[model samples]
Target: MAKGKEVRLTIVLECTTCVRNGGNVNKASTGISRYITQKNRHNTPNRLELRKFCPYCYKHTIHGEIKK
Candidate 1:
């Protein structure tokens, strides 16, 4: 990771129950600054998660990236 390097990110919208909130994940907002960390021993950014409130659900939920 270099200074001022841009990381590839995907913002997914989710509900408190871990279910897909909207029709797709890409329709979510990305205005917030996210902190990403490695999920496994390999030290790669495998897990993409964001904690945010879903207006549809009216609660905080864990939004995970949807792989194509």
Candidate 2:
């Protein structure tokens, strides 16, 4: 982890079984998810990247920026 760059990320593993089985019943914070999805969809922030994860889902999702 980078100094002063460590962040809290919430992610989804895209597990269909989890979704169908109600494993993802709990609502996760979608802040990072929305940001990543937007950037990935538009292909913006080219080359700029950041690492994030969802502790609940145990997914290693990525983001463009880290929040304080």
lDDT of each: 0.44, 0.40
Candidate 2: regions farther than 4 A off: 1-25, 28-47, 66-68
How far in Å is the alpha carbon of 31 misplaced in model 1?
Answer: 21
Provide the lowest-lDDT 10-residue window in model 2: 29-38
Pick by TM-score: which candidate is best? 1
Candidate 1 regions off by >4 Å?
Answer: 1-13, 16-44
How do the residues 1-68 of candidate 1 rate in per-residue lDDT, one tens digit apiece? 77435454433433434343333334454233222332332344664566766554445667655443
Best by lDDT: 1
The residue pairs found clashing in candidate 1 are none
Report residue 22 deviation for candidate 1 (angstroms). 10
Model 1 TM-score, all chains together: 0.39
Q: What is the C-alpha RMSD of each candidate to the true structure, in Å?
A: 8.2, 11.2
Using all chains and alpha carbons, the TM-scores for the candidates as numbered come to 0.39, 0.23
